[model samples]
Target chain A: MQAYANPTRFNALALTILPWCVGSTVLLFLVGLYYSLVVAPQDYQQGETVRIMFIHVPAAWMAMATYTVMALASAVAIIWRHPLADVAAKTAAPIGACFTFLALVTGSLWGKPMWGTWWVWDARLTSVFVLFLLYLGYIAIWQAIEEPAKAARLAAIVALVGFVNIPIIKYSVDWWNSLHQPASVFRMDGPAIHSSILIPLLIMALAYTMLFLTLHLIAMRTEIMRRRIHNMEQAEVQG
Target chain B: MSFTAPHIGFVLASYGLSALVLVGLTLAIVWQARSTMTRLKDLEGRAAKRRKPAKQVKPQ
Candidate 1:
């Protein structure tokens, strides 16, 4: 991990792996979408409306997972001062923000049909909303601060503080009597959903994971280039 | 998959909105990266040219 912390080495590694990531993301999305939309059987209760779970569940999963990654990266940046860690955290924010937005929007879309409400202040929903705000706040920190070091420091602190919300988002359904459904896939009772629907959900989850990997690599590369440009400009000005 | 599911419009809207937002965000990031790289390259090239003439003047 430390070896890759060097930006030059990281860029080399990213360049090699990026093609594979792109290829896998494309292949997985194609197969996953086909399986999700065509092969997966409709839910006995929700019927065709269950199709939304294919996209929604995976997106929500990515939203949570990306936040966790950002928090970890931020921690590394703060604790170890890993050269590339700040870049990783900064590059991840927009991608995670998009996923969080997708999760909320899709959740709302699902809610309106099932819960008969376009929006709700329920614990699960509210926690996820807070997660979205955290992403926004983190991004805004970077934009608001003029100095790069100061921006990264402040943003890292915000990311770490916001890490508290992740568990709440995860357990909100369990803790409260909410409209949101309890965990089925990761629960001890072992997947309340049937295999037919479960297969598509899993595929979609894989697709979302691959998509995150693909985007993260690209974002990191662009960030590295941006930093290089910044350095060159500084040198030019000084010389 | 029933063609007759209730709230089909909502489902479609959700997917459409997600796609639009994702595509737009991706494009915006890519554009910014490209533009920044181009500006950096231009600035560095000009700097190199200025240094080259200064070196010649010093030798004379």
Candidate 2:
């Protein structure tokens, strides 16, 4: 990990790994989609609406997972001043924001039929909403500041501070009465769901994880290139 | 998979929107990568050209 603190080494490593990530993402998505749409059985109670679970659950998971990645990267940036750490954190925000948005929208779509309403200000929903705002706020800090170092520092602080919400989002359903369902997949007793449903759900989750990885690497490479361009421009002006 | 099934719209809409958003995000990142790489290479080429010494003119 420390080896990648050098931007050049990180860029070379990212280039080497990118093709594999893209290939795995595509293969996983194909297999996961097959399992989700065709192989997975419908729920007896929710019927067709349960189909939404494949996308909704994975999106929610990625939303949290990406934010966690961002927070960790931010911590690395602050503690060690790892050069690529801020790049990782900064590149992750928009992707995380997109996942958060997808989760909310898909959850809303799932909710209307299941809960007989479009939305509820329930603990789970509200906490996730706050997370979406945190992503936006962190991204805003980066954009609002002109200096890269200043922006990175401020953004890292925001990410670390906002991370308090992650646990709240995870436990919201259990901590309070939520229209959202409680932990079924990531529980101590192991997934409460049957194999038929759980298999495809897990596959979809893997697919989403690979997708995040692929996107994150690509975004990080772009950021490194962008910074290089910035440095060259400054050099040109000085010279 | 049945179109006539109840609440099917909700399920289809969820998948449709998810596909749209995820694909859009992927495309945007890929496009940015391509553009940034191009710009960086262009700048590097320009810098290299600038650093090259001017050719000596032949004496009249």
Candidate 3:
């Protein structure tokens, strides 16, 4: 990790690994979609409506996972002053926000048929809403601050503070009377779901993860280039 | 998977929306990266040109 503290080396590594991420993401999505649409059985109660779960669950997971990545990067930026850490945190905001938006919309799509409502002010839904807001707020901070150094510090603090919401989002179903369903995949007693449904769901989740990774590397490289341009402009102005 | 299945519209809508959003986001990021890479290369080329020593003129 320390070896990647230099953006140039990090960029070289990202270039090498990016093609693999893109290929795997495409393959996973193809296989995952096939299983999700054709192989998985319809739910006993929800029937065809359960198909929404394939996309909704993975988007919801990635929403939280991306923020976790941002918060961890922010923490590293603060603790180790790792140069690329700030870039990682900054670039991840938009992607995480998109995931959060998908989660909310898809969750609503799932909720309508299952719960007979488009939305509810429940713990799980509300907490994830807060997360979406956090992403927007973090992005806004970077745009609003003219100084990169100051923005990095302020944004890092905000990310670290907002990370408290992740656990709340995860366990909200258990903590309150959420209209949302409780955990089926990750549990102390092992997964409650059968393999038929679980397998495709896992594949979709992996596909989403790979997609995030591929996008992140591209965003990070773009950011490094932008920073270099900024520094070069500053040098020209001073010299 | 059957189009005739009950509530298939909702399933289709969810998948459609997710695809639209994710693809749009991915495209936007990739586009930005391409433009930024072009700009960086341009700036680097200009900087290199500035660093090059001017050719010496022979006394005429």
Candidate 4:
């Protein structure tokens, strides 16, 4: 990890790992989709609509997970002063936001048929919505602030503070009477879901995770290149 | 699952929306990365050319 603090090393590492990540993402997604649409049994309650779980659930999981990744990188930027930390945090915001947006959209599509509504103000739904807003707010801070250091600090604070909502999003269904279903796959005891459904869901989650990793690496590399260009331009002027 | 099953439209919409968004995000990120890499390389090449002429004119 420390070795990657150098931009050159980080770039080389990202280049090496990127193809593998992309390849595995393709393979996992194919297998997961096969199981999701073909092997997983339809729910007695929701029927074919349950297939949407393969998409919605993984998206929701990634939305939360990517924010956590961002917050962690932000913390490193603040506490450890890891040079790549800020870039990691900065690059992650838009991707995380995209995933959160997808989660909301896909969740809505799932909700419309299962819950008889296109939207709801339930605890889980509302909390996840707040998370989406936080992502936007974090990204806005970066864009709004002209100073890089200041923007990094402000974005880090927003990310750390916004992390409080993650737990709320996770427990919202349990804490309040809500339209959203309680934990089935992630629980204290264990996943109550049948193996056929659970397997595909986990595979889909892996695929999403791989996708996130691939995008994140590319983004970090891009950020590094952008900074280099800025520095070089400044040098040309000063020289 | 089955197209004959109930609420199949919702299932399709969810998957379709997810696919669309994920693919779009991937393309956007990849494009940005490639653009940045290209710009950096271009800037480096220009800087190198500028340095070469200066070195030639110098005492060394």
Rank order (by DockQ, best first): 4, 2, 3, 1
Candidate 3 per-residue C-alpha lDDT over B1-60 given as tens digits, one digit per residue, 9 for 90 to 100: 788888788999999999999999999999999999999889889888777644334334
- Candidate 3 reaches a DockQ of 0.85
Docking quality (DockQ) for each candidate: 0.53, 0.85, 0.85, 0.89
Among these predictions, the greatest lDDT belongs to: 3
Model 4, C-alpha of B12: deviation from truth (Å): 1.0
What is the Å distance of residue A114 in model 1 from its true position? 1.4
lDDT (Cα, tens digit) per residue for candidate 1, span A56-157: 878888888999999999999999998888899999999999999998888878877765667766556677788999999999999999998999989999
lDDT order, best first, reads: 3, 2, 4, 1
lDDT by residue for model 2 over A63-178, one digit each (tens)? 98999999999999999998999999999999999999998999888888876777776666777888999999999999899999999999999999899766766576546654
Tens digit per residue, CA lDDT, model 1, B1-60: 456677778767776887787678768776877787687678778878987987888964
Instruction: Estimate the lDDT of model 3.
Output: 0.88
TM-score of each: 0.87, 0.91, 0.91, 0.91
* lDDT, residue A219, model 3: 98
lDDT (Cα, tens digit) per residue for candidate 3, span A126-192? 7788999999999999999999999999999999999976676657654565355544322111236
Deviation in angstroms for A1 in model 2?
A: 2.3
Instruction: State the displacement of the C-alpha of residue A110, model 3, in Å, after optimal TM-score superposition.
Output: 0.6
lDDT of 1 at A137: 96
Docking level for model 1: medium
Sorted into a CAPRI-style docking class, model 4 comes out as: high
